[model samples]
Structure formats: C-alpha cells, structure tokens
Target: MDRPEKLLTTAQAAEHLGISRGTLARYARDGLLKPTLKLPTGHLRWSLEDLRRQMRELREQGGE
Candidate 1:
C-alpha cells in the first residue's frame, strides 16, 4: 500500500497522537493545532508533520 503524502483528518490525527477527537477539536479551537485544509464538508485536515509537532508540544507541556 502506498502511504499518503500529507493531510490527515481529525480522527486520524487524534489516533496517531493517542488522543480523543474532542481534545483534538479543542486544540484546534485554541489555535494550538492548525488545519492545513478545510474541506467543503467542514472537515479539518492537518499535515502529518504538523500533527506530530503538536503531539510533541503537548507531551512537553505535560497536561495529559
């Protein structure tokens, strides 16, 4: 299978970071997480690298 190059949906990104969708949504709202693409269906998409960066930041902050 071919790997996707970029952009993950909220669910995928959350799963990768081992977080709930609600938490991801809140991060997005707080501007801690930014979307690379906003689909017509109102779904937010984030780059894999960006998601990983956010996860790293969260880990550093130790809020969980």
Candidate 2:
C-alpha cells in the first residue's frame, strides 16, 4: 500500500516556489500551473513535487 501525498496550501506552495500567492494563483488561472486538488468548498492545494518541477522548468526557461 502506498501512503498518500500531503498537499500544500496556496500560500505554502507560493513560498516554496519563491513567488507571491497572487502569482501562484495567476499561474493557475493562466494554465501555467494547476492545483493538485480543489475541494468542493473551493480551497486549492498543490503538490510540492510539482512546484519543484515547475521551478526547474522556469529556471530552464530563464523565467521567460
């Protein structure tokens, strides 16, 4: 059996990615990123692993 992955809140994810919460939300809105989970109440959650991958991609792209 595999353990469940712990998802992070928007603010936490933003901090980990070294970006503002607004920028993180904007990235999600613009389709540059997507929340790993969204509750029925509209709360968003992100995967830290995904954020790291995003950071790597951004660095590779020179943040263009």
Q: TM-score: which candidate is best?
A: 2
Lowest lDDT sum, 10 consecutive residues, model 2, at: 55-64
lDDT of 2 by residue, 1-62 (tens): 99988999999999987889999888888777778998898878999997788767876987
The residue-by-residue lDDT of candidate 1 on 1-64, one tens digit each, is: 9987777888888898788988888988887777788889988998879778767787798844
Indicate the residue-level lDDT of 41 in model 2: 86
Clashes of each: 0, 0
Give the Cα lDDT of each candidate.
Answer: 0.81, 0.84
TM-score of 2: 0.76
Q: Which candidate is the best by lDDT?
A: 2
Residue 12 of model 1: what lDDT?
Answer: 88
